[model samples]
Target: MTENLDPREGSLTTRPTAADRARALLDPARCRGLVPHDAGYLQTAGIEIPATRGFGQQLMRTRFYAGVYQLGRPIGLRVASALQAPGRDEDRARTARSLRLRPGHTVLDIACGPGNFTGTYGHAVGRDGLAIGLDASHPMLRRAVADNPGPAVAYLSGDAENLPFRDGVADAVSCLAALYLINEPFRAIEEMARVLVPGGRIVLLTSLAPGGRRDRPHVMVMERLSTMRMFGRDEITDFLRALGFDEIEQVTAGLAQTVTATKR
Candidate 1:
């Protein structure tokens, strides 16, 4: 699933072959009156994609952005964690376990780059359940459609600040290593809370903040290299507590943090 490195091919073309299949994963009633387009995804109107610009945005639109993790090396989990700890294979399993999913439960994967975990979630939920991946990047969504095709899975173009689904549409929601990329991450988490049903599980993996702030080019370069936002956790933890989530917990791995909670 590596994208073209050739400068001439800045981005991959959107293939139509999987559009029909992805369409089947959408529930008519679940959409906020937005129809799935011919390119094989529903989108939030006026929402810009890639979330970022320049190098990082280009990287995410391609397959190599994730660059591996505890269980997925090369594009979905902790890159440093995979390299420093045991690499790629345990990430998805741990995430699934945290969700405590059951067969036939619907799941929404926000910021699902390349739809990597979308396919994983689909399998976890089984045939009767639905797994929907949402990302603002068209190339990522198109590539996701090509890379991960399943009867129970689909991809859409949407902004994290405002999820496009109606209230309480998902039994579980997972956002992995993507919240930091959004401008208003806590607001996005609130949106995740809005789409989830009562007692539903939520899981997130994001870049961990450094112990203290610093004014240094080295730190800035490191942040760019890893696509991490070196912001602290007071806001996130406080927000979760205010939301009345149960079992809220956060764990660190390499440069990443895994946060799990349940809607009240």
Candidate 2:
């Protein structure tokens, strides 16, 4: 439900009514651990939210637009899958080919929404290997757990910037179509590097602007609504190189790019 705002007060007003604060404090989602516990009361109240925060936090504060996406997660994911079926299949095949996964190779899939690529990774790794799909959204994790069931596949709720894994524990790590949504892309990349073994592959697929064109309408909307920002090919390569990654290769498909690098 939308926040209960006073009729006399303008939308931009920083001061929230007592009822608004009370409603935010009593929201079940916040207490149920669906949202971050440390979020400020004003944020939870959906008033005067700052722009310098993670997309997950912003989504949580809004309850995914009054539970529209949350309630219809399966349908939303199905629609997304249908719309991107060909591209998603191609990306998965490319990733599978590039990673050349073997039996008993541990793989981590960050921001693995609905286990789209995570299941592919699991099958690639086979039963002997582990495939963990990690995402910050609880509903997404639930969908992933329900849809991608296997002994080798598991789902965990975790932040991409701060992965919940030991150092150099993975044979491969992948983050597909999600880096742009992260507030701290560098930190997330560093975490991916930290969890990867030497020579392990890191696969990333994300929206990119060719020739530094960041003025696209969709990009601007995402920036305003979710704090997302597009990256260039060279910018990403530089980040990878600085983090000890080598042999970086980028392949563009439409507005997104698939980047594969090896940890050195």
Candidate 3:
């Protein structure tokens, strides 16, 4: 229900012009599709940050890590280079199958980081299918585009809380390892529900409490960080149900659980 407004307009005086709306629509910030526009916008608004409290250093490292992970070839190479840690590969495969992605399905990958699951999703949908990966991080999206350049795949810089897409525009919506970052997770879920066509599916991959951890420090740390504003399995299921999703179910694969819901 968020309305488009121009930056120059007084509190509620003037409405956004078509040109302004188009520009805003094209803005990368709009692409994130998240709520609390301030958070996602500020995070990517090119504000210079000096190294302090480890935040700047962390950002650097994250950019680097994201860059490396975004490299689809390297990602595949790494996966191929060594056997996936116990249940890791199996988990991904299981999640993809659970989504039932097939030819002709149009997918919207919210918070798709470096096309990790995006690649698997591409295969699931086949050539006729379309996969749009939306993310707030431009650097990350750039890497994704560079690594996995091809037809039927597009990278969008947008938030999840307020998706830019029209109503009921996608057959499936998927967010992997990134949904927990949004301060308003439920709002994003509602938007996901809005964008999906009737009977369309949505998959949210996260480290739900019911899914026991594997004693990996990095994994634990990541989960802890995400938990800052994230919800547990029950909370997610309830939220999705409240958002009008039907047949909501929690499916576990290794340390991660995929919350599956269908548009009512």
Candidate 4:
């Protein structure tokens, strides 16, 4: 049986309490259509039952991020856009310049939320190049397609850990903000490496909570709700190196880190 809770019903004030939001995060029915669900064995007859792992366990293996995107899509989109708005253009330009994307290079953007990086990449690659945006959420992909329309841009539904493309099809690849949310982040990185042509660049932007510091309340809440652990600089670098990537360069920007590496 699925439990449905509306985000608007409980609190007296317009805003929901932290507890309310947290409770909503635990609802299994919220993720029913978006991901698969598995029912575990019953502990005792009419006494206790084991909770199904569902898609949350299958992908992120966390209660916080199990149905996060599907549940928070509207607010999440706004938050993502607003946060990136301040440095959106400049960041995109810097990444494009750093990667040296030309008119004919194909770029793959993993977890390309709401077409932020996808639109910029599409523009950077120009008419001759292709910018493919892959994301697991259908609503996000719909918004991405609606917001970024061009012959050079395409959107697909896929998980980062298991990318849908063939080997060595892209000249460059990028994943932003959503890496830590993945359960097998290294597998996702391997997929990124797999999809890139030899010598192709891979750019990543993700949180850096060194020593697992939870200084910011919002960041802390997100991490708690999503059950995601941030990766340190060395951990990411080691993964890239082990995957045969070279010339790794990492730079910190506020709480986030940007890494650029070349597949060797």
Best by TM-score: 1
lDDT of all predictions: 0.70, 0.65, 0.60, 0.63
Best lDDT goes to which candidate?
1
Model 2 residue runs over 4 Å out of place are 1-86, 213-222
TM-score of 4: 0.64
**Cα displacement (Å) at residue 227, model 3:** 6.9
Q: By TM-score, how accurate is candidate 2?
A: 0.67
Q: Could you tell me every candidate's TM-score relative to the true structure? A: 0.75, 0.67, 0.64, 0.64
**Residues 1-264 of candidate 3: C-alpha lDDT, one tens digit per residue:** 225454666454443322232233333533432232321221323222222132322442366767665433334433422433235456556657767788867787887777666666767776567777777665666666666544456565556776776777788888876555564667888888888899899998654443343355654565466343324547788888878888898865433456888888
**Model 3, C-alpha of 32: deviation from truth (Å):** 13
lDDT of 2 by residue, 190-251 (tens): 98999899989999877666444676776676567756667765778889999999989986
Query: Model 1, 1-264: lDDT tens per residue?
Result: 223244567766433322343343434554433456666666754445534744555566664443322124444443545444333346676787789878888888898877777888888888567888888777677767777767677777878877766677789999986876776788889989988899999998777655433245765777777565654555466688798788899876656667899999
Residue 45 of model 3 has an lDDT of: 33
Best first by TM-score, ranked: 1, 2, 4, 3
Ranking by lDDT: 1, 2, 4, 3
Q: Is candidate 1 or candidate 3 better by TM-score?
A: 1
Task: Give the higher-lDDT candidate: 2 or 4.
Answer: 2
- Model 1 residue 212 distance off true place after TM-score fit, in angstroms: 6.5
Per-residue lDDT for 201 in model 1?
A: 94
